[model samples]
Target: MIDGALFVVVLVGALVCAVSAGALYAFSSFVMKGLTALPPAQGIAAMQAINRAAPGPAFMVAFLGGALLSAVIAVFTLVSWPGEGGPLLLVGCALYLFGMLGISAVAHFPRNDALDKVDPEAPASAAYWRDWAREWTRWNHIRTAAALAAATLFVLALVR
Candidate 1:
């Protein structure tokens, strides 16, 4: 029963990580490009709107829910220390929880918060918009990679 529950959790965690990676990939792939191509004010306004809208239910479910699931998987792995799947479970949880969520908290949110403080139409805001888009997208790539990697690890754990 415990094994069955752990398997379900791992499966859900993998799916969540994949969903997160897909969302981040969209930003890194085209969303940032499309937004940045606009005039600075327009781009800034759009990004600010996106940031404002990001904290709602669906995203919170994937983002926070993924973290919560990862934490559970980590605890389970530590407690049981199963032969084959244990290391994968631990690493996958760590990568998703720390690499994806941790980077977002430490690197991305600060920039988003700073962007919120600036006037979208201001000259300084224009310069900052360019810099922000570049830096934010770069960091997002890292997040995308982490989530994708976590998903892969979880799937591997499932197979093993």
Candidate 2:
């Protein structure tokens, strides 16, 4: 019963959310494990390099665009109050916005900032890297789940 335009928006949002989830999943499932297995200095330096590279347009479009589209979809859904699909859309938007992006902002970025300040070769950096990588990967798992859940909800909304 959803309108065509809204359907398209939700579809695109789901795809973007899935992309973000996949990226996070990669980190959680293997990337972090691989990085952490490297010598601590190497791990720290590699993570720093990754953090530097992550903010570019390719990744930003998928991550940021998902949030942006979620907002748009949420607002539209609320204003229109379209049948059963409406609540699903709202919850999906909430998950993508708060669960995914919010966690990244509140949890990941601060850690990355702290990592940036560490001297990778220092003994202290090794200690910090151990904790940082563990904590960062844990939060990434949460983000991955959130994004994947949001994408699932988006699909459910479409089918409803």
Candidate 3:
């Protein structure tokens, strides 16, 4: 039926988005490691440099792309969610959507906005930079988890 076909497309899109999120998560870890390894003074400098570069645009692109894909999956799942395994797929899709949107709106976007105006070469206190990095990493972890959850759900929907 048409519903089944739509479901298939959504599932594939969800899986692709999930994979992309995982790749982004890995990149985040790499950035964290690089930041953590620096001496306090250099770390602050590096953080400022990164912020000034406006890394937020990249996150926004990724977040929006994933969200759009997940929305498609959610819509299709909703349309045909009365059959066998349909409810499960719906729940999974909902979780993924909620999680992705929540993190983007609550954590990532705020940090990105804050980073936009920071001066790269201006002297910053160590505590401030340390706290900021920790916060960023924490949100990154949330995003990664949500992406994984979304992938798992899509895979389940495909199998069932």
Instruction: Give the alpha carbon lDDT tens digit for every residue of 49-134 in model 2.
Output: 99999999999999999999999999989988856688888999999999999999999999999999999988788888889999
lDDT of 3 by residue, 21-68 (tens): 676587477977787778756766676566566447665555566677
Model 3: clashing residue pairs?
Answer: none
| lDDT of every predicted structure (CA atoms) | 0.90, 0.93, 0.66
Clash pairs for candidate 1:
none
**Model 1 CA deviation exceeding 4 Å by range:** none
For model 2, the local distance difference test gives 0.93
1-160 in candidate 1: lDDT tens per residue? 2357888998999999999899999999999999999999999999999999999998888888889999998988898876568888888888998889999999999999999998997878888898899999999999899999999999998887
lDDT of 1 at 70: 95
Clashes of each: 0, 0, 0
- Give model 3's clash tally: 0
Q: Candidate 3, 100: how far from true, in Å?
A: 2.1
Model 2 sits at a Cα RMSD from the real structure of 0.8
Give the poorly placed runs of model 3, Cα more than 4 Å off.
Answer: 1-4, 39-62
